[model samples]
Target: MDLYTFLYDLATGPLLWISFLTFIIGSLFRAGLYIMASRKMDKVTHEHFSLKYVFLGLVRWILPINRSVKKNPVFTILGYIFHICLIVVPIWYVGHISLWEDSRFGWTWTAIPDEWADYMTLTFLAIAVFFLLRRIFSKDIRLISTFSDYLLLVVTALPFLTGYFLSHGTLENVSFFGENMELIHMLCGELMLILIPFTKLSHFILFFFSRGATAVEFGRRGYSV
Candidate 1:
């Protein structure tokens, strides 16, 4: 096969399946581990469990006036924007919905206009850069940052940057990476998928459990949390 066809096949075929399986299995395995570990802690803190407080605690975090959000308004706002764009662009962009329709199910949803998606993508990229710089220059964050932290930042940014270039035909205009630019962009996305459960990205999944524990503890104190 020629270059474009070969790259297309790789992106849409085997690599897609491999990456998806990795993401699914890895996520389940990590979640299982968290569940098992939480059991031991549950034994000790069983009295702390309160269904009412669990939901209340989660609601407290969702509110903008929560202590954490209040402590870092700028970070919280940018972080929420970044996450919104990150999720909306990929899932709702025309190109992506088409791909998902073809690959996963014969269903497609309305897509965000390309122009708006482009702006959102840029915003997410900018926020990602800010996060990386914060990790590097902020003393407290720097103290806790690890190599994986840096790697996560890079991996997270790669797809957004490459996708922007791909959409704008920047790579094609320069003949950058020959005809493989789209493939590279797709690979970066798949790499991110595969890393989600194994890396700090797992926090997305574990957030609920952590917040529930905190809520239980704090709710018992008779505060809004």
Candidate 2:
């Protein structure tokens, strides 16, 4: 088989399965570790755990009805937009929904229009650039940022970048690093999935646990986080 066909098969078949399994299992393992550490180091967190407070904390932060949001409205707005697009575009895009339909389970769902996906993808990319520039230029943020921080930003944005190129045929005639855009997009996506559970991106899952714990702790003190 040719190189592209070989890579295409690998990316779509075993690699995809491995990426998903790693993401799911790694996330669970990390979560378990967090729980164990919390129980051992801060038993009071469990003692004070309140499901009600946990839910409330998640809602408040999700809606972002917080002092930080109030203080930095522009940043909050952009953040909300970025996150919404980041999540919605990938799950609801027509191409992704088609992949789900083609999977073994034959799952199918409604997808957003192609136009909407394109717009959201562009918006997401713009916001990602904005965030990167902020980290570079913002004094306080720059002080706290590390190499991993910038690397993570690039890693997170790469799949979307390549997907945009693939979808729009932006570089269909041009080979990049000796590979077509589709291969790059698929590899980037698989890389992201594999990295998610091992890196800070695990916050996608762990955010709830951490937020809930904090809320429970604060609620015990008669305060809300």
Compare the candidates by lDDT and give the number of the best one.
Answer: 2
- Candidate 2 segments exceeding 4 Å error: 177-179
lDDT of 1 at 122: 92
How many clashing pairs in candidate 2?
0
lDDT of each: 0.85, 0.89
Clashing residue pair totals per candidate (backbone < 3 A) = 0, 0
TM-scores, each model vs. reference: 0.90, 0.95
lDDT of 1 by residue, 67-90 (tens): 778788999989889888988988
Worst 10 residues of 2 by lDDT: 171-180
> Could you give candidate 2's per-residue lDDT for residues 1-225 as a string of tens digits?
998899999998999999989989999999999888989888998988789999988999889797779899999999999889989988899999999998997999899999999998899999999999999999999999999889888888898899998888887667673358888899998898899888999998889899999989988899866
